[model samples]
Target chain A: MIQFYDLAGARDDQRLSPYCWRTRLALEHKGLSYDAIAWRFTEKDLIAFTGQGACPVIVDNGKAVHDSWAIMEYLEATYPAHPFFDSPQAKAHALFIKHWTEQVLHVGLTKQVVLDVHDMLADRDKPHFRSTREQRLGMTLEAFSADRDAVLPAFRAALSPLRTTLQKIPFVSGERPSYADYIVFGGFQWARVSSERDVLEPSDPIYAWRESMLGLFGGLPAKTPARGAILAK
Target chain B: MIQFYDLAGARDDQRLSPYCWRTRLALEHKGLSYDAIAWRFTEKDLIAFTGQGACPVIVDNGKAVHDSWAIMEYLEATYPAHPFFDSPQAKAHALFIKHWTEQVLHVGLTKQVVLDVHDMLADRDKPHFRSTREQRLGMTLEAFSADRDAVLPAFRAALSPLRTTLQKIPFVSGERPSYADYIVFGGFQWARVSSERDVLEPSDPIYAWRESMLGLFGGLPAKTPARGAILAK
Candidate 1:
């Protein structure tokens, strides 16, 4: 059996982390059945027990896999019928995109979205959002905002390569969805589900691709009750 | 023919980066012949031609592979013999160690070493060090130092898991050397090469394991360059 660990009380519109979303979508795409566990950010003993302190960890047949990319690789290797990487060249391309998505695109998106989680969350969750942010980042709101703003330009510049790369390929690796698609999809879907509409409008092909992904996996049920909240934490 | 694009005079000691070493070592391990193009870090145009502003970008059979992990993956896929990932379970273990090496270990080693490059390279070449660092990080020495100090804790914490993981398995993925070994080798080797005595202390099984790797590959001409300066651009 496959087990997914996520955040509880997470809302569809307010669930904003791309990393968590990628695993959930992959499970759906592979048509894998799994149990879900919503974990609190501050209460990380469960994660530590597995020798990691991060979420979106997947456990399959008693083996625990942490890190989204590793988890995806595990799934692909274990279940070859629903292949995540088709060809050798395609696999290389997918790995490139996966690294680019995590190291570059994710950094930019996080800076843009993380600062406004309180405003993005439901009215009742504002205090919870603020507290969670403080706990995770160990910084006051003012400091966090400043730090976020400072990194925006670097983030923007880092994104230019990706934008150019994506323009050439239909998907991150072209045509069918590869691991790269799932990686980018996690972040883009988070922004689409959580942030206001206009946030992604300025970007053209990226926005279009994101909408297509949403339509593909929109039917899957929320993996955890707190996916949105877990992402926020 | 395989072609490697590397910086000509950079001091990326194992402590500073093991990614470069991984690629270099892989080339020797596979017993592949290739032309090595040593690049200066400040030479953005050269790196940009490869579509990334990073060292250790390799072009194999006309295909470009950037990022150390991706480059290694490309090598494993392209040259299946002397395989980097042997089995599904081994691949999973390799991916896990790769993630930890890149995300956790590399981050820390970069902080401890790159931040002090100016001081370390003062006798050798100041202008080159300054220019190279500026190009790689896009920041002045003062700014880079601050950034390095900030990320130190994360890097330090990265070691504990490695220590525990290494205790169980001789290599990161057990008996045979895989991509994980190469990746971790990059970071640990950097630390060792930069300073005989430094942050990543050569103690216990970690040091013993590294010595074993060096001894294992030490005989090959391709593995052991005449001088470190030849490869440091």
Candidate 2:
């Protein structure tokens, strides 16, 4: 069994890290059973063996792999069945999706739910999360959260590509749930787990797609305790 | 040989329509020969058989297909050689890239070179182009072109995913130039053929990738006349 280091929040099961959610979903997609250990943002020393402070570090048969994308790559290479990428070109294109998710979707979504995420953090993790995110965002968490309502339209507008894509296909990776689906879904899952503020209108195709994703893997992700879910848990 | 209806400017060789460019490139990628007919904005009656006024319409063996995306689909279904998409999933994923290029890249690039594009059009195209565009843009061509310098940064910033992808891979479609590359390169090629203003710094990986794209198929696209090229034609 793989030992997955999952980022936890106020509750041990409150695993709200988007990157960690990607890895967890990838594991489930591969049908790989794992023991998810609840880790906190400030627990850098616990994952020191991987030389990174991230919660997505996975230990499979004593081989440590950190970084969500790297872990997906590792899993695909190791398992070789139920492949995440259909072809080399698919894998390459997936990199663009990954970058778009990281730079565009994640960046847009963070402003929407960062304060809510901060509130969900454990006492020991709050200070570290605040300091790091505040420095990176170049504004206080409250200040970043303040303009979210005003900026919501722009954020939703930026999702034009994703919305258009979903209108054409059922999953981001096409007919089946694959790595690409997991990559984008991670951000939505994070927002869902951390905030009650509905990022998506129920009428949206994306809202429906997210519902189907939540129903996947025998409702594995839906079983997790969410902070304030807008949709049925 | 297929008959391709390509949008032409003042000079017949000045083929600057980004959507049309995608079909042309797809034709080239599939090793198909095409007799490109010069098309103007006001020439709606010319392609009335297709029931649409798009320049990207391709009349293949007496079959008419309109829209750049639909044309590519028709080409793929007809040719089936040198596949544009690796699998159904790749094709599905390409839709997202198509939307991104259309909504994000093309929209940003248009404001930068709309006036220049107007200058490149034939006398008959000017009125229709201006009237339709000005109405859609809610401003005159001159007004839209005014903030090009100020909006250049945001335009460049939106290319973050493409820039990051090109930095890692030689082409947008993994190791080989596929439909995804053509979909995006069409936007750059549109800018190149219409305006002298350099959208990319020479240091940028996208500039290098564009050079490679131009050099493809025995320099077929490079043979076309450009307005005021910053790079060697």
Candidate 3:
């Protein structure tokens, strides 16, 4: 069994890190199971043995694998029978999707949800999270996202590529979902779990794709507890 | 032999439409011979047989295939020997790349070089081109691109996904250049052929990839005549 050190917010069930979601999806893709040990930002000491502060680290049979991309590659290489990468070209394209999601989508999404995520952190972890995030953002959480509504048009416009692609196919990887789909879904799942604000339009093809993604692997992502969820709050 | 209706500017040698470039590259990738016809912007009547006003309309053995993507699919299906799309997943991912290039990259890139492209137009076609483009842009070309230098940083910043992807691999399709590479190279090639200004910094990884792309097919793109070329003018 793999021992996955997953990142969690204030509530143990508030698993909001996009990287962790990617790993979890990868594990499920490979039909692997692991104990998702709920870990927080300040609990860096818990994963210090891995020689890294960040996580989605999976200690598989005592071999710890960190970094979402590494973990994805590790799973694909280790479980060759469950081939996620069909070809070198396919893997290379998937790598583009990964970077696009992280470097582009995550950059824009962070601005919209950093404050919401900070608020969801454990009370003790707030100060550490706030100081680091605020400094990195160069403003208070509220101020950073204050203009999100104004910037919404630009943000949606930036999604032209993803929107255009979804308009053609049901998923990034075509008829069926693949690791490439999971790679992109990570950012959206993180945003979904962390914020109530909708990033996608209900009528969008992407929205339909997200519904299909949420329904994947027996509703794994959909089942996760949405942070600051208003359904019953 | 394929009869590719290539978009040209003032000089017949000045081929600058990105979509046409994609088709030309695709023809080369398939090891097909083509007579690239220089079709100016005002010469829409020349391609009326295809029922479209687009260059890149390939008349392959009397069958006119309009649109770059439709041409790509036609070539792939017709000449199955040179298989760039190994699977449906591969094709789907490539489609995403195409959309990304069209929607995001082209939008930003046009702002950078639309005026230059206008400058490169045939004297007879200039009026028609300017009226259509200015209306589409909602401003005169000069006014539209007046602040291009000031917006350079943001334009460069918008290339986050492409930059991040190239930093990881030599090409968008990994070890070898594929249709996906050509899809992206199209926009840059258009800019290169139309403008003297370099869109990429020499130090950027994308600049290195562009060099690799330029080196492909015996320096086909690199050897093209840069329009209104001031370096030697």
lDDT of 1 by residue, B63-113 (tens): 888877677778777887887654443443344345545655665666666
B1-233 in candidate 3: lDDT tens per residue?
78899998877888899999999999999999999999987788999998878778998888999988999999999999888777777788888888888887898898899988888889988899899989998999999999989888888987878888888888899888898999999999999999988889999888889889988899998888765364467
User: DockQ: which candidate is best?
Assistant: 2
Share of reference contacts found in each model: 0.00, 0.67, 0.70
* Deviating ranges (above 4 Å) for candidate 2: A229-233, B229-233
Candidate closer to the true structure by lDDT (higher is better), 1 or 2: 2
Question: For residues B1-233, what per-residue lDDT tens digits would candidate 2 score against the true structure?
Answer: 89999999988989999999898989888988889999998889999999877789888889999999888888888888898998877887788888899999999999888898998899988999999999999989998889899989889989999999999999988989999999999999999899988799899899999999988889977877667852355
Measured with C-alpha atoms, the lDDT of residue B101 in candidate 2 is: 93
Looking at candidate 3, what is the lDDT of residue A66?
Answer: 94
Q: Write the per-residue lDDT of candidate 2 for residues A1-233, one digit (tens) a residue.
A: 99999999878988888899999998998889999999998889999999868879999999999999889989999999898888887888888888899999999999999999998889999999999999998999998889999999899889989999999889988888788889999999999899888799888889999999988899978888666653345
Residue A62 alpha-carbon offset, candidate 1, angstroms: 17
After aligning candidate 1 to the native by TM-score, how far in Å is the CA of A117 from where it should be?
3.5
Q: What is the model-wide C-alpha lDDT for candidate 3?
A: 0.86
Model 2 residue A12 CA deviation in Å: 0.7
Q: Each prediction's DockQ?
A: 0.05, 0.78, 0.74
Which model, 2 or 3, shows the larger DockQ?
2
Lowest-sum lDDT 10-residue window in model 2 chain B: B224-233
State candidate 2's DockQ.
0.78
Give candidate 2's error at residue B216 in angstroms. 1.0
